[model samples]
Target: MTPPELDRKSALFLDLDGTLLEIAATPEQVVVPPGLPSLLAHLHHQLEGAVAIVTGRPLAQTDELLRPFSASAAGEHGVSLRYADGTREELPAGIAVPSAWREELEAAVQRWPGVLVEPKPHGFAVHYRLAPEYGNEVWRLVRQLVPPEHPWFHLVPAREAVEIGLRSASKGHAVERLMAHAPFHGRRPIFIGDDFTDEAGMRKARELGGIGLRVAEVFGGDPANVRAWLMEGAQRLDGRSASSIPTGVTP
Candidate 1:
């Protein structure tokens, strides 16, 4: 067992869905666990601004979900950055997503049953949870619409669906970029997440001599694995605390 230590140079990386918030059928319907903002704020202050939420969701969505606390966020894998300093940065200027492609992808998904296509300011996504069988078909059409010239756009495969976003971003890249900045930089990276996309950040965090806590869900497969991982991670965090672990659950 790894002995817990109060390392001042520790940067905590967390994933929103299945980490800070529970995953839902639609991205828009997710519930923000009560007191999560406050708990994150406490963690942020305790870690001296070494806390960050690295997720596949868009940066703006992550910000909106973690209202009040708005801890540093890396969205769309890591292509976008929103720092504590109140600045948001996107990838290179040349990689702007063309509107035509967005509409094309949206139209393509509309024709497929159980496929929910959403438009992002930068890219697009095709949700196939309702029609899991169409997963590969959705990817085929999406791939046809995307050209290799767009260096910032790529497809990210999740549990039940595939998301197309800026290619330049990822959880691992976000962690690297965040650590290069103040407070987050120069700290040991402790990443917790429950998704295939999060593996990059986890691997990177371990390479940096920090811990990668995998949260597992109680049911389901991989997502469940993430929920379980988080439960243990929370316990680990609780055990090291001088005080009791603050429950986000309201009595």
Candidate 2:
């Protein structure tokens, strides 16, 4: 089926790594190709400031890369949110994982070479991308640290990493919350992502009367395709004539 075209009423929610940017050995290693920020800025204007980056990384990290061209954003899988007006909100108080757990997790993952423990204000992640062979071992260790039955925390496994965080946070809830506010409200939501963590946003988008586009085998499973798609859509939104739109390779 042909994908839906973005229009005036569309609100776009996008994932970062693997969707907008190519997945890297480590989260910090991901590259933001030239023109991406400008493209996002164009779409944000086209959509009337309804564009957002819903990512697993922190808003600070997202800002670090997308500075001077910010839009709405939900970071740490919805642990926090920032609107176009620059207002910020976070999961209610008392939802953070205990400091002791963070300390323990940090010390435990050191045994495995190439394994990195990234600490967030609300949770922590164990990345084994550099040491894919240790994926199972990393999961096993994380499971022990944050058992499945834990009341306040749960595990989110994605790519080659496992994140343990507050049970109240998720990409779906983030989308729902943003849609209830200005700009996003009354718009059909379109979410695009490329990983398991992105599925929640996808479902929420469809439920809210839009669609989810996946960057998998069909789209070459790469960020270039996503950029190309956005470029075409941006051109269309800009009212560029069909003949003037670049007929580049499909993603």
CA lDDT for candidate 2 = 0.84
lDDT of 2 by residue, 124-187 (tens): 8889889998898888777887887898889998888989977888899999999999899999
**Candidate 1 regions off by >4 Å?**
1-7, 147-152, 217-251
Per-model RMSD to reference: 3.9, 2.9
Tell me how candidate 1 scores on lDDT. Answer: 0.71
- For every model in order, what is the number of clashing pairs? 20, 1
Tens-digit lDDT track of model 1 for 3-41: 234355668888878666677888888887665676667
Error of 2 at 234 (Å): 0.7
Clashes of 2: 1
In order, the Cα lDDT scores of the candidates are: 0.71, 0.84
TM per candidate: 0.81, 0.92
Best-performing candidate as measured by TM-score: 2
Which parts of model 2 are misplaced by more than 4 Å? Answer: 241-251
